[model samples]
Target: MIGAGMGAMAAAARLAVAGHRVVVYERTETYGGAVRRFERDGFGFDTGPGLLTLPAVYRDLFVKTGKEPLEDCVELVQVDPCARHVFADGTEVSLPNASRAGVVAALDKALGAGAGERWGAFLVRAREAWDRTRRPLLEEPLWPNWQVLAEKEPYPAVAHRRLLRTRQARTLSEIGSLELRDERLAALLESSALAHGLDPRTVPASAAVLPYMEHAFGTWYVHGGIRELARAVYERCVRRRVEFVFGAEVVRVLEKDGRAAGVELSDGAVAEADHVVADVDPAWLKALTDRPLDGNGDVRADPFMTRPGRFALLLALRGGCEAGAAHRTVVHAPDPESELDFLASADGDQPPPPTVTVLRPDDPALRPDDGHESVVLSAVVPSAADWDEEGMVRQYTEHLLEAAEAVIPGLRDRVLWQEVRTPDDTDDETGAFLGAVPAPALAAGRGRFLHPSNTTRLPGLYRVGGWSHPGGGLPHAGMSGALVAGLIVEGPEFRGSR
Candidate 1:
């Protein structure tokens, strides 16, 4: 495997079981890609994705290894997913899990009857859209590299949904502001847009799948830190006897007879495999390609460029944060005008701190009420290129703390220890180009061609990670990894030389 990111590890585990000799190289001393963690005193914090909703993926992973998921890996308890909106106008409303009825009732009480019905109607449509896009595109890998662009069944509907302007664009107190109105609900909907680094006025409706899926599947937290996912994959690979070459920085991918042969490391060492899979960002993988191939065989990963860097804060706290059965995506978003205004300029390749995600919406274990609440606030910040380490640290620490303090009184003073992970940290640590964390931008304007997808470019090579097709995000990443594995090993007809 190219890089030992989580997706890469998952792919490596599967490929190894399929009887291919697998070797993984990682630049860091540790493995897990974005699944990094930190702790101080009595408190701990997961530096990356904490709210894992899709349990089936993990279940399937363990089953593949002939092990029980809960026994072999971390146990996951379903969280009652709900988004509580604290609008600037000083109104707070919560929309809860699969309880679309409750959401409608709440909206009727807060917004309008018409608005409530509209939301329900849209929820139904969103669910349908999810169903339509689920299998053929979202859960499947682009095979043969030509089917997507060739004379065959292409995913135009799925592509259209991803590329078009989201429902957030037309409504919710922003640009279009179509029919039913409750300014508070409007603000809540708008806040959801910023929650994902998207502009409410521009993000496509498909993005709404997050809320719908959260309600349907239920939000969840791994018993320990979410980083347990990395641990599980690592253990599986080890059991399969996959060799993990830590700190082996690969510099070039060797091509022989016009097919992938092996990789050359920075230390002049070489590791050969039947077929190579890239787990880093596409741009990063491109750098290692001794000579760049067309790389255009699949538009899934290479199609969409990247988004800006994220300004993240991992604070080991001295106190606990409350989380009930349901979770809340806290967005201390400035007013709509300010939020949209900032989003427009965000692409200047400029770093601006506006949105703040206070994630432990639910999960008292991670954030105990008695004490030990790990708070992580990640916002889009200026790239490492824009500022020096000292400057970046100072900015992230001050701005994010101030924002958190407003939500939790005396938060800055309560902080026992702080570790600031700038977008630059993401790049330097994960080799993500432009410091792109998790997934890059699939802007509304560019719409259709976004999302990291497609495993292989042509016949032999495979790609997965922050820059591949189907786009980035924990589920997308995991799904893309499995799809690639399935295509290479279990697909009805592709013979990847092993």
Candidate 2:
């Protein structure tokens, strides 16, 4: 195995159970890749994703790998009133967890009269897209003739009567405008795509499944933070006797007789193995292989369509969290269009305050004491931003902090210290190019935006991680590991996890 991220660890655990001498070579000294923790002055914050959705992906891994389940390894708490969304029009809605009816009711009450029903009706179509793509996109490996999956838009979009001709909504933005009707409701729908670094204007309607997946599974936080989930997986790998070599950066993949034989490390040490499972990002993987990866024989240099990075503000405040606050609050941008445009632009145009996701886990383990609170403010920005400059980082950090005051009242006054992390930090940590964060795989129409196949061109080599098939996000990354292990253990005929 290569790299000790969640996907690599997951593949290691499963392969270990199958009696493979799994050894993970990570460039960093730690196990988790981008899922890292920062601690200072008795306060801790998760530098990556703070919440987990579609946890069943991990549950299945635990059930299949060992005697104890995932819950036994890490405490999982479902966030009630999953998130609070403050719209541009001063409309605030507290969306409950895993409840469609509750969401509909809340939207209706908060937005307007028929707002809930419109959103509810849109979810029904989203459900169709989910069911249609679930088997092919999630459960099954990318097929040989995968163009069928890409060309077909499974989202049963409502035909809108605009003028003379009735046309079905194609893009996510079109669906939001034609079906959702209201601007605020459209923003609500667009948030799912924007969160994944996808542009609502271009992403196919299949992207609707993104929101459906979250609302269906419910957002959950590990007791300490999301980094704890990585710890649990690493611990499980240790219990199974999977060896981990830290700081062993793989320089090149040694090929023997047209197959991957082993890897040459940065320290000039060669570790030979029968098979090599790569958990690194796409660019890093290509550099190791020194060739285009085999994805139905048409692999591009950069497989990803949209590579957006996160700008995170880790704040240690002096006061405790209020009695009952939503675990996650999205301070929506006043001009959603302009914000999206700025995130889409490569040049550093000061975006009108980007939509910020403020995460404040109620877990006491995160803070020094009840008196202190650990809050994270994260916003999606262009990975091409000049984040290497201190002035740019400082300016954006302050902008996010100011926007966060909408939820965390008097945030500037209460802040004891702040740490800023840019895409450069992500690139340094995970080896991703330009520190670009990969979005979850979306079946963009016209055979566009689909992730590369897990089984690459090189024999005896496999791809497993956010940058591989099924794309980024916790559940997808975990599933990528499962798919890779299944292919190696059960051969190319393997469909997916049963």
Candidate 3:
């Protein structure tokens, strides 16, 4: 295996149990690719994902590989009132965890009468889309005739008449405008897509499943920090007898007679293997192979346009967290258009402060003590190159903190010190070009955003990770690991995990 990201480690554990002597060669000195942690004066912060959704992916891994389950390794706590959304219009709503009725009532109470009814109705349609695409998109490998999923929009958009002409919403923006009919409701729906690094305006109606899945499964936070979850997976790999060679940068994937044999390291060391499971991005994988895999029938000609990387602010504050603060709060941009415009821009000036996802976990373990708190503020921004401009990064950091002020009143004053993480950090750490966060695979735009096949054209070579088949995010990456393991162990006949 190459690289020790969550997806790679998950695959490592399973492959080890399957009787393969998995030797993971990660370039970095540590494990957990982007899922890393930062520490300062006893304050700990999860530099990668702040929370976990659809944790069943990890649960299944533990159940299959060991006597202990996931819960025994990591303490999973379901965040109540999953998130607090503060809209530009001063409308605030704290949606409860996995409670449709509760969410409906909250939306109604916050956005006025009937607002929740429309949202509830839309979710029903979104649920249908989830059911239709769930298997093909998540559980199974990409089919040969994937064009069917690409062309089909499973979302059942209601028909509407405008100027005596009938039209049905197709894109996410249209659904927000024609169906939800309220700016706050539309923002709420669009936020889900934005969180995935997708532009809602162009995202297919099938993207409605994004928000539906969140509300159905509920959001969760692990005790200590999300890094603990990664640590647990790493330990599981070790227990299963997977050997990890940290700082062992793989320069080339050695091939013998047109089949993958093993990997050659930067230090001129080579380890032969029966098969190679690459958890790195496609570009990196290609560089290692020194040749392009067969790609005449791939999903897209270019996959780098998926989404931009993250700009984060890890704030170590002087005061404790407020008593009734939600674990996560979204401070919506006053001008959604400007924020979207900035995110879409490649050379444009920093657009208005983008939407901010503020994570203020209440876990005492995150802080030095009760007197201080660790808060992480993140926003989706342009690629790593944009952050290269020190002036631009500083300005963007200020913009993020200013928006965060809405939730953390007197936030600037409370900050004892701040650590900024830009897209560049992600690139240096995970080796994803421009540190772009891969958008989740969707069934629209002819499957343009879908990742490449896990089973590459080169025999004995497979892909597993966010940048591969199932796409980004914790659950999807885990699923990619399961799929790759099944394919390698069971051969081409393996469809996927049953």
Best by lDDT: 3
Query: Taking the tens digit of each residue's C-alpha lDDT, what string does model 3 give over 33-82?
Result: 88999999989999999998899999999998999999999999999979
Candidate 3 stretches greater than 4 Å from native:
161-167, 301-306
RMSD of each: 5.3, 1.6, 1.6
lDDT for each residue of candidate 1 in 147-196, tens digit (9 for 90 to 100):
33222211112213555643333222332244234555555555544555
lDDT of candidate 2 over 160-241, digit per residue (tens): 5666566677899999888888998888889988888888998898899999999888999999899999999999999899
lDDT of 2: 0.87
Give the poorly placed runs of model 2, Cα more than 4 Å off: 161-166, 295-306
Which ten contiguous residues of candidate 1 have the minimum total lDDT?
150-159
Compute the lDDT of residue 145 as modeled in candidate 3. Answer: 72
Q: What does the lDDT come to for candidate 3? A: 0.87
The lDDT for every candidate, in the order shown, is 0.61, 0.87, 0.87
